[model samples]
Target: MKKAFLALMAIACCHFLHAQPTRPNQPATDPANTQAPYLKFPTIPPFHLLKLDSATYLTKDDIKKNRKTIIMYFSPDCEHCKHEIESFLSNFNKFKDIEIVMATYQPFSEMKEFNEHYRIFEHPNIKIGRDEKFFLPPYYNIHNLPYLALYDKKGNLITTFEGTQKVDTLMNAFKEKKK
Candidate 1:
């Protein structure tokens, strides 16, 4: 009887071991279950952000299919962000072919002020918007201000840069995506 009990206990232990949950730090083995926080290069994730108008929303589908996309995350209060925006504005002609989406988590009033100050909305290629719920920073694992994510014409991610970067560097990144 004791032998039978021991055998049952061993079987239970084996079953428990096999049924253990996956490690907390390890990603799931199932392809469907494993979704990275940030979209990898050549992969595009669906996103929805709010426009400064407080009425319209910009989704992945809103992106132009033929134009490469540059998504810039900025804070109105950050000096580096201001510098980056100024650089982009100064070199606006170089990026006329690309679609620029400048998003920020700052209040609508602040965003509007920043947009007016930089005349960002005056450009046909650039769209200044607000992300009120703060969805992007965490989704992209952004650790610094003036983060930039460049995507190909097909909407696939090309590269991501955190902190201030030169306009030429950004242009080159987009150019590299074509190759």
Candidate 2:
């Protein structure tokens, strides 16, 4: 009886050891799930984010034509992010007409605080909004704060910057032809 039980135990162990997990079939890859959605989507994404007021929303339609756009991803408390904004603001004349949309995944209060601290209200051209959908981060593959995506007047991507900002460099890139 003992031998029979030992043999059965050994057989069960062997069977279990050799067994493969029946993994569920993987779903087909969606176009949006590609390596870099932005690479596939070179143009500015159709994003709808909540404005700082938490009342109205900012969307693709809100973007003005004949104006270049800068979609900036930032954290309000981030010093680097603050510096980037300062750089842009100091060179305000160059960026005055550019539509600047600052989106943050941080809480609305922080966004509001940052806006007030920066006196963003003064610049109707610069909009700081809350990304309630959390879209721009993944869309831009943001690994650092203050990621800026510059789009041409035609709503086509020029290039991107991570962790830093140079006003002259941005202006040059914005003038590039789309690939």
Best candidate according to lDDT:
2
lDDT score of residue 151 within candidate 2 = 85
Give me the runs in candidate 1 sitting further than 4 Å from their true place.
Answer: 1-36, 40-44
Instruction: Tell me each candidate's TM-score.
Output: 0.78, 0.79
Put down candidate 2 lDDT per residue, 1-179, tens digits, no spaces: 99999999999999997675544574335544445677778887888888876889998788888889999999999999999999988889999889998999899999999999889889999987888988888787789988998888888888888988778888878665543
Q: Lowest-lDDT window of 10 residues in candidate 1?
A: 36-45
Clashes of each: 0, 0
Candidate with maximal TM-score: 2
**Model 2 poorest 10 in a row by lDDT:** 26-35
Per-residue C-alpha lDDT of model 1 across residues 1-179, encoded as one tens digit per residue: 99999999999999999788779887777756665467543444566667767799887677777788888899999999999988988888888898888889888889889988988778888887787778888788788989998888887788999999998899889888777
Full-model lDDT for every candidate: 0.83, 0.85
Candidate 1 Cα deviation (angstroms), residue 24: 12
lDDT of 2: 0.85
For model 2, the superposed segments whose C-alpha errors exceed 4 Å read 1-33
What is the model-wide C-alpha lDDT for candidate 1? 0.83
